[model samples]
Each structure stands twice: as C-alpha cells, then as structure tokens.
Target: MATSKLHVAMYPWFAFGHFIPFLHLSNKLAQRGLKVSYLLPKGALPKLQQLNHHPHLVQFFPLVIPHVDGLPPGAETASDVPFPLHDLLISAMDKTKDQVETILGNLKPDIVFFDFGRWIPSLTRRLGSMSIYYSVVNACSMAFSMVPAKGLTLETTLDEQIQPPPGYPSTTVIIKRDEAPHIVLVNDPPRAASFCLRLTAILKESDAIALRTCNEIEGPFCDYIAQQYSKPVLLTGPVLPETSATQLEEKWDKWLNKFEAGSVAYCAFGSQITLQKEQFQEIILGFELSGSPFLVALTPPHGYSTIEEALPEGFKERVGDRGWVHGGWVPQTLILEHPSVGCFVSHCGFGSMWESLVSDCQIVLIPFLPDQVMGARLMVQELKVAIEVERGVDWIIGKESLSKSINLVMDKESELGNSVRNNHVKFKSIFSSKDWQDEKIGTFVQDLQFILESGK
Candidate 1:
C-alpha cells in the first residue's frame, strides 16, 4: 500500500517578516512532495507571485482582508498600514476567522501551522486537524515572551522584566523594558489586552509549537520551551535558501564591478523601519568617513519624497562616486553576495541576519526597533559575530560612532575586527554545512510524520 502524504496548511501574521518565512517553509514541504496550502492576504499575492516559481505541490490562496473601523481602505498587509493603525489591521485579521474556517473545510489539511491566530487551534481541533503555533522570532525572545505569558504583562516591573527569565544566567539576552513597546509591558490598552488574551488562548489550545531557528543557535531555550509547555517544540533550521545570490540586475552589476574585491559596504534596512532625516545623514556621513565604497537603500519617512530631500547639503558632491544612496529599493541579497561587498550595515531583522550569516560579509549592526535590539544582541553579544554601533545615553548614535563601527568591521587587521571576522567565518561554516541543516530539518519532518501517522 502507498503511504499517504500529509497535507498541511499555513497561516502567518500579515507582516512580510512573518509571511516570507512561512512561504519558505511551505516551499520546503512542497519540495519534499507534501501538499502545502498557503493562506495570504489578497494584497500580498503580487509579492509572492514574483518570488514563487510555480511549485507543483504548493497552493496559494488569496483571501480578501475585510476593512476595520480605523484601518484605511485597501490597507491589507503590515507594510500598507501605519504603525499606529496596526491594531486595526489585527482586528481586521480577526474578522477573517469565518473565511479561514470556510477554506479549512475545503482543504481538509491534516495539520495547520499558524502565527498570531488565537482561534485557529480550537477551530482545527474541532475539525480534527492538529494545530501548531509557529513563531517566526528567535527562541530566546520566545522564552522570555511566550514561555511564562504573564511575565510580560502589567505587573512585571521594568527592572524585573529586564532580568533574564528564571533558569537563565543574569547576563543572557536581558531586554530593557523601554526597548519594547509600552503595551508589551502594560496590559491596559485594548490592543495590548487583545494580544495577551490571544497569546493565552493559543498557548492553551495548540498541540505543539515551532520556531524558525535551530537547536545550534538556541538549543537551551528550545529545550526550555518544550519542558515548560509539555509539548513538542520543533526547530525549522532558519528556512533560508541555500544561496541568496540570484542574478544581479545590470545597473548594480555595472557599478559594483568597478569596486575592488571586498571593498564595498552594503547597507539596507528592511521594509518596516523608517529613518528620520538626521539618522539617515549620520549613516551616509559615517560611510563617507570610513573611506570605503558604499551602497545604501532606504525608504523615506511618511512625508519625504526622495533621498536627495533627506540627505545633508553637499553630501552627494563630497562623496561623489564613492557612495550610492538609493531611496526606494536595492537588490540586497545579490549585493551582499557580490565579490566587492565586505560588510553589511543592517537593522538586524532576522531575515537580514540570516542572509548576512550565509555570506562572507562582516557585520555592522544598527538596530532601530525593539525586536531588532534583541536580534542585535544575539549577533553582537551572544554570537560574537557582529559589532554594534554604540548609541549614547540619549540613545542617539552619532556619525563618529557609526563611522568607527564601519571601520572596525572593514579593517582586516584590527584585533576587534579580526575577532569578529573569525567568529563570522565559524558561523558561516555551520550555517552552510549541508549535513547540519539536513539533520535538523530532517528530524523535524520525521517528527511530523510520526504525529500524522499516530493520529491515523
């Protein structure tokens, strides 16, 4: 008798940070000959259409996102909505429970992996489908935020919250209370309350939990989560493509080809965080001061129109051909893999971090948001593979400090620079080892098969 292949459904939070990782996992499952159904907001389909090249076993379902009271019309994904209006989008997503249920009925998947869907586990349980809560963040953050659930709520003081969770050493990945959103610390506001309630529900109802990280990177925390939840916690091996170096566009190829090998600094902040005019100038000037050829891609803040408007006076003429400041988009992965690229200046988003880890590039991390700070700490403090640009007491990083960080990462012979480069090389070997990735992901798949077969 031919064994039946399990069918799986995936529902990720509306943000690209979450959506892209989920898509990668779906592709991997499909490649392994399992039927995979991916649920995406209608507005997000175009982006996926560009990346997904018609995998045979993966099906894409584009669902309309209903408008909520405060969210603007047609604002479907997190990128489309402003930060303040994010709660409205979450509310709108909750309204899709009926749509999700209708689709699940038709798909009849054996299991569903979900992010930020409180009702999904109960719904899947009632329908005889197993539910797995999928976290896209690193396990250390999950250990702090998701493990106790109550530790992050209103009663925990700023001082108390900064301490590492119990069983962890005091020095391990401690997050400052102010680094996170106020709602994350206090539970009063409706959005915060809603978030807490949903997290509580998902933890109670889900059959298992999964993270897009490896045991190598977060083994202790992964073990902690399994014991705390009394359920299987699977590690998905970062779900990174073997190589991010796709074909380069001609314009970049022409410019990048002129630079000497390992002489260029590439800077990009992923789509979410927007930089103010002053912060943008500091980065540009810092690059100029480092005396390295550089290319940067930035998205303007809400009102700004172009890079020129944001740049300081004479900025272009001063650096002339040595620098490139592009406003909207740049081919980041291609640039990172380019021979001339020596260093990556990044916001430390997990996607970018994974991309940098795979490349030979050294790292200069300047994290902008709360979660980004945790990721930066992981790289600079925990992993020791990246150097962080130091901010002053006011939490403002000046051009001098930024330039120093750049120089340190780019310098081939400096003690600090050599240490960072050596650590990065060690990580690259581990990240690139086919044997390691195969073992981790293969174990996860075997576990899933066991779950499916046992259910039958």
Candidate 2:
C-alpha cells in the first residue's frame, strides 16, 4: 500500500499572527504531499480560505468550545475579543483541550503540530500521536524567556519559566539573567548542543519541537536549535505568498485613487499588543501633525473604558480623503508594496517587520508593548533599516516623538529618509533576489520528508 499519507493536524491559538503562520506551514506541507488539517473556531475559516489556494490537501475543523464570560459572544478570533492576554491564554487552554480531544478521537492524525499554548502537551500525549510544538518566535527568544515548566499537565499555578537545560550554548540564553532561575529547563536550545539531546530529553519525553523561522535570516541560530533538540528543524520562511511591485501597486490603487507615488503611510500593529488611551491619542495627533497622507489599521482597546472615545476632535475631518482609518482587516502586504506608500509606522511585530523588509519601504517603528521593543531595537540598531521612536516607561510614546519620527522617515529629501530608503532597497534585494521559496522552503520540505521516512 502506498505509505499512508502523513496525516498532520495543526492547532494555533485563535489569533491572526499565530493562525497565519500555521496556515502557511500547512500549505507548504500539503504541497509536499502531506495531508494537513487545521483546527480553529468557525469564524476564522473565511480568513484562512482567503489565503489558501490549495484545497485538496488541507482541511479545517470548527472547534466549538464554550465562550468565556468576559469575552464577547460569538467572537471567532482573538482580535474580536477584548480579553487581556493572560485571561485569553487561560480560556484558550481549556477550550483547546476539549476541542483537541474530540478532534483527535475522530481524526487520529499521525502527527499533530501546535502553537505553544499551555494545554497542548497533555492533549497530544493522551492522543498517542507524534506531538510537535511549533514555535512562531525565534527559538533563542523562547529558550531565554519562557516561563518555568511545572509539569506537562495544564494547571492554574505553574510559575516556572521555560529555559534550556544544561549542555546547550551557555552564552546564547534568550531570557535575561535575572529571569533564569524561574525557568523550567527543557531539552531545547540555548542549553543543548544537538537534536540528539533534545530528542532524548525533550522529544522522547514529549513528542517533537519545530521552529517556524527559515535559514536565510536565521541560519546559524536555527542550526543551533536543531542540533540542541536532536530533531529536524523545519525552516519555513516568512510564509507569505509571493507578490510583485506591479501587482501590489495595482491592488493599492484600486483601494484609493490618490495613491500614486509618495502619498500614503501604511500603519498597523500585530494582533496582540494594545495601546493605552493616552498613547493611542498621541499617535492619532502625530499622524495628523505629520501632514502626510496615511492609512492606519486600528484595533480599539478591549478593556480600557475610554479607548473608543479618545480620538482627537475633528481628527477625521482634517485628514478627510487624505487618511483612512480601517478598524477591521486591511491588506497589509498589498499596502506596503504600493509605490505611493513611502513609510510604515508599525508596532514592529516580527511578521510585520519581515513583510515591511521584503516590501522595501522605509519604516518608523513605534513599538507599543511586549517584545516589540526588542524587535524595534533590532531593526534600528542591528539591521540599520528603520528609525525607532523614543518612548517613556511602559512604552507611552509622546505626540512630539511620534511626529518627529514620522516626519524624519517620510521626508524623502532629508538625509534620514534617504538612508532608510537605501537600506530598504538593500534588504529587499537580499530577500527578493534569491528564491527564498526554493532555498528555504526546499530544505524544510526535504528535512520534513526525512523525518517522516525515519519514523521517529
């Protein structure tokens, strides 16, 4: 009998950032002849359907977990809910366990790949399939900053940080030193030297672990992670469908007529971070003050009582037709590709950063919260590609700082603007000239094939 098609199931937390990457992986796996199934709530199906072109090899299951009390009813995606990250995680864990158990019983997948939501370990173990934890962030980041592990079982009070155990690269710890003691040592990297270590200690104890980053941008670090884990590292790249400048401009032009050249600034934050009302107002005013045409994707705060009412008076009128505020989904890749889009004001999510880099647009980073600050620092300091806005404690960026950063990047005649544009071109050529699809995705497919054949 033809070897049964490798049956794989993917479970991502119901956020667009997490879901999109997982979907891209599934599409790649499907192209490589593996059968893939995605488990998420029903409402996310349309979004996935829009992105997916390969229907024959992949399928979706609508999970029917009960809604949490505080979350909005019928909220399909995390963006739809106003719940805080911690509460959302808790509810997702409970719901995921119930939904996954039911799906596993019916589907009996050969392998289940999941985002590192808290409930996956127990659910995968009970199912007796190869359970692979697919992390969307850099392995180094996770290794250093993850909470200590208590046990595989999902419980309320596991205060342990996740860290690499002994035998990994001692110097490459991703978390801060002060946070080290609280971490639960794992077989993954920054601690282990090779996949053999990870396999024997972590994978064998659990199932498998995979990283979502590719070799082009993160080759050495990815090699380190794979060696430490002793398991195949799947180097899926940025995981976006390829598009050209011509096509991108066409799409943007269709949306708004005035976008011809150097007209619009594209702005968006990744799904998770929220801005305080004061900071949000500062951004609104900053964009108003910059006098540049702009398009902003804003997700109103879920908890803060005053969020929706915080827009500056006459804000919409002043920027009429010159600015567009999309409270829902905006086609980001399309906007960035537009020739008229000169600069990006972004929250600096890695996915957004990669998208911006590939699009060859000048970027002004205004990080609102979490690891975004680190990403912004990387772009400004290490990559020398983007300009970062100065912010006070807790990332409350002021209007003046925001206006200055936007003006500096958007001013095409200015030295700072020219430098950013040059860097943007350089980064674009690096990523776009090479067939990242072939170099990165090709290797990932080969390794995944090897893993499947090896039967371990």
Candidate 3:
C-alpha cells in the first residue's frame, strides 16, 4: 500500500501580491508529492482554474461566501472590491474563518499554510490542523516592522509613526499619516513583534514557520529571525516557475524584433495600486521626453473617466508607433525576458523586482507608495542594481529629470547603465541557476514533510 500524502491547504489574501506567492508555495508542495489545495473566493476561481493544467500538482478550491453588509455584492476577490486595506483585512478575516471551517470540516488537511492575514490563528485552531505562517515579503522588512531588536512600545498617540531604532544606519523614518479605520486599538503590553510575530509565537506551539525568501539575498536577516524565534526557518527563494531560456526567447522574439538591441524600456507597476490622472500624465510626459522606445502597462486610474482622457493633449500622436500601451494584462514574464528590453521603469513591487532580476534587465526605480519606496531604496542603495528617480513626496517627476534619468540609463557607455547591467548579470547568475534549487525550495519541503510525518 502507498503511504498517504499529507494534505495541505493555503489561504492567501485576495490581492495579487498575496495570491502570487501562495500559488508558488502550493505548486512547490504539489511537486513534492503532497496533496495541495488553494482556497480563494469563488470569483477568483477563473485565474487559478486557468493554471490548473499543471501535471499531478495542485487543486483549486473556490469557496463562495454569501454577500454580507458593507461588502459589495458578488465581490469575488479582494481586488474586486475597493475597500481600504484595514477594512479588507477585517472582512477577509471574518469571512475566511467561516469558509475555512466549512472546507476543513468536509476534508480535514494535515496542515494549513496561510499568509499572515488577520484571524488565521483562530481559524486554524477551529479547524484542528497544524498551521504554518508564511511571510511572503522580505524577512528584514517583516522583522523590522513586526519585531525590533530592542523591545520598544509604540505610543497610541503616534500609532502611525515608525521611528528607526537607535544606531540604524538609515536616516529616514516611516510614518503613517492615516489609519485604516476598521482596526481597533489594543493597549496590551508589547509582546513578540507585530501580528506576524504573534503568529510566529503561536506557530512555535503548533508546527513551524516558513518565509518566502532565499539565503542568497536575505541570509543575515533570515538568520536573525531564526535565532530570535528559536524555530526552524525555511527560506524558499523567489517562488517562480523554472522556465528555459529558449522558452522565454521564443515568446519574446516577436516583441523584441521591432526594437533595437538595448533600446526599449519596459514599465509596469504591480497588480494592485492605481494612479490618479495627474500623476499618470506626468509619467506619460516623462516617457515622451526620454526619446526611447517604451512599453508601458496602463492600469485604470483610481478615479478616471478613461485612459485616453487621462493622457495629455496630443500625447498619443507624438509617441505613435514608438510606444506600446497594453491594458488589462500583458504577458509580463515574456516581455521582461526579451533581449531588446534593456531597462525597467517600475513601481518597485517585490514580484516585479524578482522578475526584472531573473530577466537580467537594468532597472530604473519609480516607487509610488507603501513598501515600494523601501524596495526601491534597497535596489538602488543596497544592491546597487537600479537607479532611483528623484521625485517628490507625491512621486511626480518633472519632464526634465525624467528625460535625463532615461537617457542616463539607456546610454550604453554610461557608468550607471553599465553598473546596472553588471549587477543584473550577477543577480541572474545567483538566482536563475539550478544548483541552488535544493537548498532554496527542497529544504522547505523536507521540513514540511518532517512536521507532517512526526504528527507531534
């Protein structure tokens, strides 16, 4: 008789950032001979179902929740509804608890891996399955935000402020001017880190804690997290599918054939986050002034009439055939892999950064809001793999600065461009190789298997 495969379920937040990592994790587990099921709201089923052809790997289980007051009717995913982040987190917690309970009652899994969403612990407890907390972001960011090296309590008066601890090299401090309205204030004593720290503490009692990062990039930070928590830390390198260079080449050849070598700049923000009309127009003008062939993925403005209406007067005619504007969705991985695509002007989202790195493309960082600024800082300051645009608090770059920056990056002999390309080559050598596969993702599976088999 064959040994029973461990059943694992993953619950990710509805946003693409959360969903993409969860999909990678599930695919990894399915490849390891475990029975993996990914749970999302019914409306999100289509995207997962599209990827369901993966051989013998994973299953998609979409759960439909009845429309509740305050939530939009027929809202299938978190992205479908336009609630504030705090409100979305709260509603997802409430809805997931009931939905996860129903699913687990029908087919109990040995373990459940969940993104660090609110109410995950309570739901996992109710389901009677061992739970693992997966942090999809960088461990440094997670640790710094959640748990400071020195124990310090945040004052309620400055609830939105994040001051750097004494002796940190960076001069900037993060501040949140606005609150998300839905979350309540708890006056409890400072415990582990933030919610994620609390979740890690709980996982210590349950099974294990896993993070989606690699030792190659986040070694020191990953070590700190492990030593502090006294738990087995698993570092799964940027969880992306392994595709051949030939495959990428084939898909991107047609797109790249139109442009000169090392000429076109690829631009995209992550899936979530939209820009207003004013900011959008500034970007268009910046690209126009650069005098380079460009491919920009246009997202709908947060509150605009249409994309065409948002553009500046006669902007479309000037660029004409030199520019490509793709709405809805484009084959991003394929586009990035193209040889003619030399530079990336990005929102500095982590997934996009990983894709840019793997594609060995030079990057021009243009971060809008949230953790993106930090990601941009890391790439430009820490890794020296990208150039940051000198923009204001509103992320508006003047046409002159934008044009200068673009020329600086696109110039083949320019020091900045050459440095970016060199670092791109180094990052590609480290991350895109097959040798690190075992140490990166294989160890994660081994640890997961141990937990499932031990049945502790």
Candidate 4:
C-alpha cells in the first residue's frame, strides 16, 4: 500500500506577529508536499490569503469569533482590540475551543502545530492526534517560560526574575522585570492568572515543543528546553521566506528615490505596539537629531486617530523633506530590503528580528514588552548584533535616549556601532545561506517524520 500523505494543522494566536510566522511555516511544509490546514479567525483570512502561498497544499479554515463582553463589535484579533481588552479577546478565543475541536475531529491531521491553543494538549490526544507547542518567541524566552511561574510569583522581586534561570549560569536573562507585561507583575492579576493557566497547560500536556530558532542562534537555551521537558524540541530555522522588493507605492517610491544606498533609517514597531504621545514625540525628536533621511511607521495608542494628533507640535515642518511618517500600514519587509535603508529601529518582535537578520540593515531595538525584550536581549546580549534603546523604570523610554540610540547605531565610525554592524553582517550571512537553512529545516522535517512513523 502507498504510505498515507502526512497531514498537518496549524493554529496560531490571533495577533499578526504570531499569525504570520505560523502561515510561513505552513507554506514551507506545504512546499515539502505535506498537506496543511491553517485554522484561524475569519477576519484574518483575507490578509493571509493575499500572500498567495501554496494554494493546493495549504488550506485555510476560518473559525467564527464568539462575542466577547469587552471586545468592540467586529474586532476579532488582538490587533483589532485596544490593549486593555486583550485578555477579553483571549477569553473569547478560548470559547472557540469547541468549534476548533469539532473541525480537528473531522480533519484528523497526523500532527497539529499550535501556538496559544491552550486546550490543544487535552483535545489532541482525545481525538487521536498529537500536538506540538510551537513557540513564536526566541529560545531564551522559551527557556525562561519553562521556568515555573508558580515559584516566580507576583511577590518575586525584580532582581530575582532578572537573574539567569537555575541551570544557565553564564547566560543573562533577557527579560527585565519592568519590561515584562503588567499581567506578569500582577499589575493585572486576572489577566496574569489566565496567561499562567494557559502556559501551564501547554507545558504540562503537549507531545512535543517546536521553536523558531536554530542552534547557532540559541543553542544552550534550545538544549535546556529539551532536557527540562524531556520532549522532542524541533528547531524550525526561522522560516524566513525568500523575498524581493515589490513595487512600492507612489508616495514611498517617490520619497525613497532621493537617498543614497544604505543611508536611510527605517523604523517600524510592528502591528501591536502603540506608542504613547510622549514616547512618540521623543522618537521623532531622536530621528531629527540623527539627521538621517528616514521613514517611520507609527501606530498611535488608542483614542488617537492620526499621526498629526500623536506627533510633537511643529515636528513635521521642522523635519520637512527629510523624513516621512506613515501612520498605520507601511510595507516593512520591502522597506527592510530597500538599498537606501541602512538601519532598523524596531520593537524587536521575533518576526521582525528574522527579517532584519536576513537583511543587511543594522538594528536598533526598542523593546517595551515581554518577548520583544527577550528578542532584544538575544540580539544585543547574546548575538551582539543590535543596539537597544534604553528604557527607565516601568519600561518607559525617553526622547534623549531614543535619539542617542539612533545616532549610536547609525554612526558607523564609533567602536560599539562598528562591532554591532559587523555582527549584523555575520548574522545576515548565516540567515542568507540557503544551504545552511535547508540543512536545519531538513533535519527538523526528518525528525518530525520519524516521530509520526514511529509514534514516539
């Protein structure tokens, strides 16, 4: 008899940062001739479909988002809701477990890859399917996550949490106490409780763990996770798709036409982070001080409607003709690949990290939240490939610090800048090697096939 075709399913957290990488992995698997069913909310399907991935091998199955009490009408994903209501969105997502289980029951894939499907571990086994907990964060964050949060509780001192977790003596912990989410510190107890519960479930129940990093990037942490969990840990090699710059819109094309190669600063803070008014002004001021022709994409905090409302007064006229500030949507991957772009000022989201690493651009990391801080740590502390814009108590960043960070990374002459830039070239070389990436991903695929065939 011909062997059955391997079928896989993927369910990612609704946030775009989480969702996009899952989609990339699905596409990669599909290319390798595995059938994939991508499960997500209906609202996100349109944008993902536009990526034009493997139509035959990968299929999207949309789940209706149930009504959430605090969630605004028509808002389905984390990006659609304001920050305060994010937990409510997760609660609503949890309600979709029944529907998800129903769909998975019918599809009956060999293995399901999931991020934030908290009920997955229990449901998968009952349905005769195995589940893989796919971490969208870096390996350091995963290593820290496997550290029991029960012991590291709300009362735990910031100093205590900042130290390296038990076994990793030499490695510095990437996340600072202040840089952690309010939920983590018990500033919001209910949300923290919910997050902890889900994390615990995933940790206790999953059949395997998968990460989006390679041994070269975070080998120690990767090894630690395997030893801690005693489960197979698959490293998915960052899943960076080979991309070329697409035709830019008139506005961006016209603006970028003026700069010399590698002279402009490209700043984007990903889809979820919204800069407060004060923070926004400081970043703009820093860009002005750096005197680099730049492009900034800002998503203002809730209640603000426009870039004009968020920026400092007269900020536009002062930097006139030298910078472009686009609110809401900007083509980030394309901009990163642009010849005129020299450096990336980012929130250090993992997807952004992968994109920046794959490009020639030097990185200036301003990480305000959980895994973002860990990503910054991995680049700056471990890899030495990026500069972090410093934040004070409670993770609030000031304008002077922002400006200084920009100037520091953009200055090729300075010692620190030269070191970081050289590291960037080194990482970019590794990420760009098709053979290296193929070897990693190929090993992961072979291991996955072994697990399914041997039922390990």
TM-score of 1: 0.90
Which RMSD does model 4 reach against the true structure? 4.8
Tens-digit lDDT string for candidate 3 (1-456): 122377888887666677777887776667667788788777777666655434365777777756556666666566776634334444555666677777776778877777645566566667677777787766765454443332323443235434443322133333332331111122222321244344444544535567777876778777877776666777777877656343544534666678887788878886675776777778778888889888888786777746676778988888887776655677788777677887788887778878877776778887754356666767787788889877654336666676678889788889888887788789888877766764566777767777667753
Query: Could you give me the TM-score of model 4 versus the true structure?
Result: 0.90
The sequence of per-residue lDDT tens digits that candidate 2 reaches over residues 337-427 is 6678887888888788778788767789976433465566567876688998876544357778877888888776889788878877877
Better candidate number, 1 or 3, judged by TM-score: 1
Q: What local distance difference test score does each model get? A: 0.78, 0.65, 0.67, 0.79
Report residue 328 deviation for candidate 4 (angstroms).
2.0
Task: Work out the TM-score per prediction.
Answer: 0.90, 0.77, 0.83, 0.90
Stretches of model 3 off by over 4 angstroms after superposition: 1-4, 53-55, 83-89, 122-128, 148-207, 244-256, 451-456
lDDT of 1: 0.78
Residue 191 in model 3: lDDT: 22
Candidate 4 per-residue lDDT, tens place, 93-176, comes to: 899999999999999988999878788888999988889988888888666654443344434423343544332222232234
* 2 against 3, candidate with superior lDDT: 3
